[model samples]
Target: SCPLILVLGDQLSHSLSSLRDAPDGAVVALCEVAEEGRYVPHHPQKIALILAAMRHFAGELRAKGWRVHYSALDAPDNVQTLIGEAERLAALYGCDEVRVTRPGEWRLWQAMQERRDAALPWRLVEDDRFYVTPDAFADWARGRSTLRLEGFYREMRRHTGLLMEGDSPLGGRWNFDHDNREPLPEHLEAPEPPCHRRDATTREVLVLVAEHFGDHFGALEGFHWPVTRRQSLVDLRHFIANLLPHFGRYQDAISDDQPFLFHSRLSAALNLGLLAPQEVCAAVEAAYQDGKAPLNAAEGFIRQILGWREYVRGLYWTRMPSYKRANYLDGQRGLPDFYWSGDTELRCLKRAIEMTRDNAYAHHIQRLMVTGNFALLCDVAPAALCDWYLAVYADACEWVELPNTLGMVLHGDGGLMGSKPYCASGKYLDRMSDHCQRCRYDPKRSTEENACPLNSLYWRFIERHADRLADNPRMKPILGNLARMSDARRTALRKRAEAFLATLDTEPAYGQGAHS
Candidate 1:
């Protein structure tokens, strides 16, 4: 009998290593295990999306003449665990070995390693879905004292021959980030993202999710994510045609009326294996070559996939098990109730959280500067913040989310992922967004009752960590500003922050619903 090829939920790509060149008569196995959906209290829509995609992928394989054995979550005889299902299927088929693509998460990878049997051998194939392999990234990082993303990005550009002219970058620059931070003008009209309607398979998964995971952290009403390869491709094309032209100019902008704001919103599809990174990058490059989009827009979009996404995955694989526990700032406060409820007077945070709850999506700025910045300022524990990020986002998986949350967002890795903490005052938010205008608190005031909490919290964080961050060359300017402030003013700011922190747990309702 042919060996059984197991496909994990996240490994839904038809080009996946285990599925590539699959032998005649090979049995492909897929399952919806309860443990995975409940592992981190994943958003209800996220669970539904994965299960629906898995079901659709299995059907696609069967249509291609492969023998597929699928176990639905509601199956009467379901084992409720991947290992148990694998063992049962292996015995039923009298298979001597099992083949699988390597899992993305460390816990799943370790589980596969521990469950290996000498009699029924397990063969783990390389997951070639990523642009760079883990071994290759490790090789690249071997001699570097600090593994910065820009250098790696340049190497990726050279390796892929993307936006390269002879030995130089296309526009004679490695980063177009400076061109991508303009705030969205009120008169500018942004295109809406493509919304994929749920099919029968997705609808069934939605019913199951609603019944089994009703108390999960997010709403399930607006669950419009693409759940199949075909739908994902449609979304990609739609984004390229309608949005890519202005993506770079307003990529960093925040707005009170828009949730997507000319963003691709393709991360969920990419992370779920419905879209390949190489193809996405190729399409963007083609758009630039064809004059549909400019160099800055194309390069900026490609850099995310070719640079940040790949870099974070490489970092996760290189440093894991211990990386999750890193807390450079020694932050130990519990995550505030507002994170879950969105019930706070901070208008920026409330809007960001509400959007996340409604759509399982938030632009990068909202994640890094709004919620993430608040966590850093208030000294919320890194582990707690990491868990919230992993649970709330539809695109989250440990490999991508861990480094982003612990290192970039929380600065918990002490500067491995980013040179400086992405800490900011309310004035920064006010300048970049319309939320501050509608907000009751004054962004310019730090010591008054009607002052924005972030203003005082920002100074409080700087003052508390000055001793540890003083030597950091990037932090000298901020430290100098702190030093210029009078001792009396500093004391007052600290007192205001302390009073706000004390009332965090008992704060009144801000927004109500599953997300809040």
Candidate 2:
């Protein structure tokens, strides 16, 4: 009988060390059951991306002459949970034991452990691929409390010899964030993003996902993401050659027309294990070394994969289940209906939402500012916003999405993930992108002419939540702006905001559903 190994959906790596040197006649199993797909009503395009990638990777494993068992979501014997399916497969194969690499999700990890304790001997393989190990992170996190990401990031640089020269950073500075925040110019044309012609296999999966999840939030016709390892490499190489040169300067800039900007659209591949973090980091480093891309660009891009990505994963392990529930602001308003429908008159909001709906992908700024900012200011519940983010984005996982949404976006964890809530007026958006040029609402006005919803909402956010936010040391400046307002003027602004929020469809009324 062959030894059995379980490969979760996220563990579709070809170079997985666990699969290497396995005894002859071992069976590797990959399943796509309801439990994995229906966890949060994932976008149809996201499901197609994963399942297509898994199937393609599975074919590669079979070509290597290993016994491969693959299951689709609609399989007749579809058991919902990973353990139950694993046990059934093991029994069917008549295998003595099962092995798997450490899972990306904590819930799956605990379930696997519980099953191992009860069932046959199950070996948990180490995920040595990441820059930091769980034990190493724990050691670094020991004793002296607060886990500041910047400090930990410096430690990682030292440990990995990344961005380092002897004991210090290469440029005698640890961070180049100030040099990396320039907004896009009015006349600059964005480079055309790389194209990946979809294969028959991917087209089939797309049809299946669309049929199954027709009522879901995002669009499927516009899905052009890479679905194979070969295409993922092409996307990475394309970014290195075309976009990496200017990625650092305008990474945070938002625009209605230009959604991808200079950002690497490689997060999907990284999350799927088609591209390793080290490989991505090393490639960018090589770009700097070869003088093809600037230091700020290379370092800034590397910081995302090495620093923020790993830090979020570590924090997920340190605090979870409850961390998903934290709503320090005590926001109770329901999410706006437009979030699900993309039917808003606010041009900035509509553009961001349309991009997300079409691609199931949005750059960091769009997520943090356009959609997430609305959720926070309107007092939508934290978990509600987090779930919506997780369900919508292709790159979202519980670990990455929750912290970025709850801490950075909502400021719900009281500034744990970010120094301040990423709150801004439509003026900031107006300065950053061309979104204002095509909208019914004017970005300049706060309470008139079907005014930009963000205008009134910005002031009303501070006014309504002043009691909770006023005492915050970091938030005092914004509160002072609110405090300086005349009582009568502030009352008018509040009335405008209330009137606007009252028209939203799904509300305990957060938005007044003002539409063109």
Candidate 3:
């Protein structure tokens, strides 16, 4: 027998480093361990999606004449931990060593490092799936005092030659973010995403996930994530033809009923290895070249994958282990209970959580402006909100989610990931969404009983972090207005925020899910 190759749940791609050049007679271990799912209270659909995709990928490998050692969730000998299962399978196969791709999180990467001196040696290979490798990003950040994304993104565009016209961007500019923030006009609609028919493998995984992880948060009823490479390709095509044309125009728009308006909804597939970022970007650029979509839409969509996604991964790899411990604002409050149950009266939050509960998905704006903004305003602890975001989203891997939650969502990293906190008042919600039309609270009132909680909370956050935010160019005007407010009105807003917060609940239903 040859060496045993350990394939992780998320590393399901055929071209994964551990499997791409396997020698003859090698055994690939695909294990559905319980520890990975239980480490945090992962959403039911997320667990199901991972297990189903793993099974399907194992089948694909077996069909291609590779020997697969699969340990299903209910197998009697299942050891319930990733390393244990892989080692157990290695022993069973009589292999001397195990080869694996370096995992996406700091904990696992550290664990793999510890395994170097084990009885049966383990080898870790670089997962070079993204546009920029970790070493390359570190080189780019060696001398900078601040690691800004715009600078890194520009480098990525030039190095990859994406949308480049002889050292210039195709649209004569770098970003189309300004052109992509219009509110919905109420006449436009989004087409339904491609409904993948659940094959026997997927159905079996769904039943297993429901039985094994039923108590976990989020619904398993509408499980529609792409489980295999073929289905992911189909979804990519559908997004290009149906959704990409209008993606840029309404990328930031929110509607009362539309949960995924003009968004790609492809992050889950992209993160899971069913689709590659390069292919996705190439398709969008071809659409622009063929005149199927505008330059703004093409550049905006490409920037997400080719720019932001890669940038965040680089940040995660370089800044983690200590970066996750960063909480510059020193927020210690617990995450509110409404985050888990979606029982709040704030329509924006309620609706966003409802989407997370029902679909295990929410677009970037909903994540940033709606739920994330509320958590930021409430002064929720970085770990608490970070765990919830990681547990709830299907696309969340620690490398991506940690930076976003700790750095961007809560501003817990002391302006490292973002220049200023993304805190927003209800006026922003009202302008960008139709949620306030039917909402009972008024966005314009800050201290009244029927006022939006975010209005006062926003000001309260401003007051709490004023000393740190005073120097930010983007925050100067907002802080100046705060300075202009009368002491009497500021006190009233503070008291009102305190009163509302007293009635709210922030206890975690689950245990402390550490950022480690």
Candidate 4:
């Protein structure tokens, strides 16, 4: 009898212990199914990237003489559910048991559990890929009431010895956030981004995705994301030498023209398991040691991978199933139609959506502040907004994307991911990017004919939801701002916002129900 090994989408890491001592005849399963993609109405490009990368990875494993049971989304053999497919393969192979690493999403993990003990002996091996383990996080959360990130982050530094100097942080400070917010200087030159030649396998995968998911959002013409460890190393080296020097400075800053900007575009690779977090962190550490990058830059870069990245993963494991349903502000507004199409007149929204459509990516701030903020201020329902984020972004995984979209962006978790809704008028965008300069809407007016849509919408959102929101400690200031408005001013703001919302019927965003 053979032992069957199940590989989930995000568990694409080669370092997964389930594959460490694989027997010669072991069966490995990788699937691309509609269930995975449509569960969240994933962006067309995000779907393409994962399916393409998975196909490439399966080919590599097959080249190593491993038996790979790869399933395309439209394959006849695909039943579209992991449990059923796993049992079918195991029964065919005459395997009495299955071995696999723990899954990332709580729903998938639960799905695996219900099926694992049904027909065979199942061994759920520990995932060795992440720096922190489930048990380690559980132990940390044991005696503590609140799992605040800063406290956990400091502990992780002590445990991993990253950014630490003899029991203290190297710079006598735990966070360099104050130094990390310098906006992109006009003359700041970005380094050359790395590119990889698409092998025959990847090209074939691309054709399959294009054929099957042609109507999905985003472009696939220049698909060059790293699909293997070898290519991922090249990307890491390229960033260390070229992008890291300025990464810390502009990591939070937004720019309309410079989509990739100076930051490392390695999240897709890192999340997909093409590159190990520790190895990537070590590469940046090496640059600091060799005097190739400044300490502020190097340590800041390292902290993202070693500190925040690991912390987020740990937090996900500690807070599950219940975390997804948290809606702190009780937000229930329908998602704007413009979210699907880049049809809005707001310059910042237009640029951000266009970039997402072109590349299936936008750095953290772009996602959080620009698009996410609009959704938050417009009172978009958390689930609908989160589904949009999950569907459109290439690097999104439920465990990672949900908390960010619902908690941080929407304040749906009531101040868990963020202290307040990441709501801001156009002035913030004007200061951060050049979008305001080109926009037809003026950032200065709160409720004029040509007022920024976001400006009117934000005030309208607060007024409509005032009864539910006025009491939150974090929301008091915004409430005060609203309370100070004269009756005529408030009426004008509501009228302007209502007009903008009414235009959604004809906007590019509401067309075709792209999310459906």
Candidate 5:
């Protein structure tokens, strides 16, 4: 009997660790289960991308002479869960053992672990796709007082020897983040992201997603994701050649008009395992060495793949099962309705949400400063906001999405993911984006009717959480500003914030109804 190898949707790489030295006649099982798509009401585009990519990968495996059992979501006999499919396949193949690379999510990993009592023996191997392993990260984090990204990132730089010059960094510094915050210039035209024309497999996936997940958040019409490893590489090359140079300077800038401004739209492919992070980083570094891109651009771009991305994954694995429930501030308001429909008075939020709805993509700054910032200020329940992020983004998997939302965005993990909550006012958004210029609410007004909700909410958040945040060294300056405000002005800001919070009840509960 041939050994049954389970290939998950996310584990699409040809060099996946479990496939290493598989004997001839080994059966690779790939399935699209209803449980995964309906798990959180995933975006139509996100569902389409994963299903299309998985189908394409299955075909690639067959071409390379690997026997595969592929199950479509519409399969009449589909058991609707990964474990059920695994059991059926094991019986059909008459396999005594099942092999799989560890899944990215804890739920799936736990499910597979409990399946040890099933009829077949299970072989779970380490997923070697990432630069750092989970066990290695645990060892590194063993004695640290605070697990910050900078320290972990430096170790990764040394381990990978990427952008490192012997014992020193290539540019004599580990980060160029300060240089990477410039707003986009009015005349600087951003290059378009490379778009792959939809093949038959992608078209089929789109139709299926529309039939099943049409009520889900995002649009399915403009599905242009790279569905195969070959197409992913093409997009990666295009990013390095066309966008890498400007990516550093404008990485944090946001524009309502340009959704893909100098940003690599390769995250979905990278998360889906169509493109390896190491290969993406190496290509950017090569471009820098050849004088095609600058040190800041190359280093900043590399840091995301090698630094932040790896750090978040490690953090997620280390603190899971409890990490998702972390809500240090005890944020309790439901997510605003505008997140789904982009129907709102605030231009920054409306634009960010619209970008996410039109394409399951938003650059990091727009996510952090606009939609994420507002959620933080409004004290939206961390879990509710986290669900929206997970459902909306094409690149969001639990391992990456949970920590970023709960910790980085909401400061729900206290100071674990970041030293401080990413709290900011409308003024910050005004400086970083063009949204404020066209906004109906004035960014400069904090206590008036029709004032930007973020402005008053920012102060209210600081005031409400002052007891917890006052002693935080990084928050001292903002706390001092809160203290210096006149009593009358502070009172008005609180009142304004109260009015804004009152309106939230009038908005539809997240995921319960159509956008108004």
Candidate 6:
């Protein structure tokens, strides 16, 4: 008897291991279940994008003469869960067993593991499309006190022979980060990202998503994501040709007017398996070798794909089932009401939220420094913020979203992903963007009327966690500065921050807290 090959929304690649070497008569199953869509109130655009991609891939598989059972969300008698649909199809097709690529999130993987005694046994095939495997990453991480990205990144460069000159780095150094942090110049122009024309499949998916998930967090009016390999390649080519040369310099710079200054918009495509990472990184490295793009820009873009993307996936697999609940600093505040509504006086946060609401995207700086930074400073529960991020963004697979929000963004993993909390005052936002120019609040002033809430909240966060951060080498000097403050000055700032915090975050973050 044949085995049922199950494909998920995120696993859209033609080269997927489950479909790669299958027998000639195997039945391929592609499903769009309601349970997946409403799991965390996923953005409508995310649902549309994935459903369209899955439909397109199912068509591709059928064209190659493989038997495909496509399950649309609106179809009568459709099971609402992945595992349920998988077994139902297996039994219907007279298949004795099921086969699938490893799932991207831990919850589904664990669910699959629990069904060992099902009528049709399940066989999981390891996905090998990336630079390294999870077990290999665990092997590298074994017996290490600290796992630094730089160290792992350099090793990947050596293994891949990318931008290397026969055992030596092409630029004499592994990282070009210092040269990549320059502020955006006023003369610099923001290039437009390529928007694909919606085909019949995309239009149908959009309508389905709207009818089902209209009340989700993000707006889908301007839904224009690349849902096919051809469209994704157009995006990759456009980035290399137009935005790459300046990507490194202004990567960290934010603009209230421009939401996607020079950053690549290929993340959603990459996460969905519409584009392969190896080909993307190779194209970037070739641009640097041909001198079409500067080394800093080329290296910076490639590192995001080859270094950070791979690192996070590895960290997620190695640390899952326990990594999601870490609250090292014991943050206990619920996610604020403004996070969903975007009704805030803070201009930087307002801009980021508006962008996410309209486009289902914001660049890395806006994510890390704006929304993520504010959550870290406010001591929001890691799960609350993590779920918000997962619900709001198009690219947020749990493997990536959990690592960034729970570990890097909130520093909730203690020191596993980041050495110190990524907390900063309003001044950091002012320096990074032009957001403060027209805002109602003062970035420089604290403990007074019209002061930016982030300013006092930042100091309050430091004061609350002074003992927790005192021993950290990077925070020692900052803690000393807090120590040198007078009692009156510190008290005023604390009172201001507490008053602002009290106005928001009324719901409990997780549970009854022993703040210690």
Arrange candidates, best TM-score first. Answer: 3, 6, 5, 1, 2, 4
| TM-score for each predicted model, relative to the true structure | 0.96, 0.93, 0.98, 0.92, 0.97, 0.98
Residue 355 local lDDT, model 6: 94
Taken over the whole model, the C-alpha lDDT of each candidate is 0.88, 0.81, 0.90, 0.77, 0.88, 0.88
Give the per-residue lDDT digits (tens) of candidate 2, residues 302-344: 8898999988887776776567667777777778888887898
| Candidate 1 lowest-lDDT run of ten | 507-516
What TM-score does candidate 6 reach? 0.98
In candidate 5, what are the lDDT values of residues 161-259, reduced to their tens digit? Answer: 999999899989999999999988888889777778888888888888999999888898778888899999999999999999998999999997999
The model with the greatest lDDT is: 3
Model 4 lDDT per residue over 286-390, tens place? 787788887788778877777667766776777776677676666666676777788889888888998888888888888989988888777667777777787
> Candidate 3, residues 204-229: lDDT per residue as tens digits?
99999999999998999988999899
Higher-lDDT candidate among 2 and 3? 3
Least accurate stretch of 10 residues (summed lDDT) in model 4? 506-515
Q: Assess candidate 5 and give its TM-score to the true structure.
A: 0.97
For model 5, give the RMSD to the true fold. Answer: 2.5
Summarize candidate 1's per-residue lDDT along 1-516 as a digit string, tens digits. Answer: 678899998898989999887778788899888888876788888888899999999999889888999988988888898878887888888777788898988887877777576677788888999999999999999989899999999999999999999889998998998999899898987876677877787888999999999998899999889999899999999999999999999888898778888889899999989999999999999999999999999999999999999999999999987888788988777778888878988999999999998888899999999989998898877777777888888998889988988899888899988998999999899889989999999999999999998999999999999998998999999999999999999999999999999888832322211221
- Candidate 6, lDDT over the whole model: 0.88
For model 2, what is the alpha-carbon lDDT of residue 397? 69
Tens-place lDDT digits, model 6, residues 28-110:
99999998998788889889999999999899889979899999999897888899988998989999888989899888888
What residue runs in model 1 are displaced by over 4 Å at the alpha carbon? 506-516
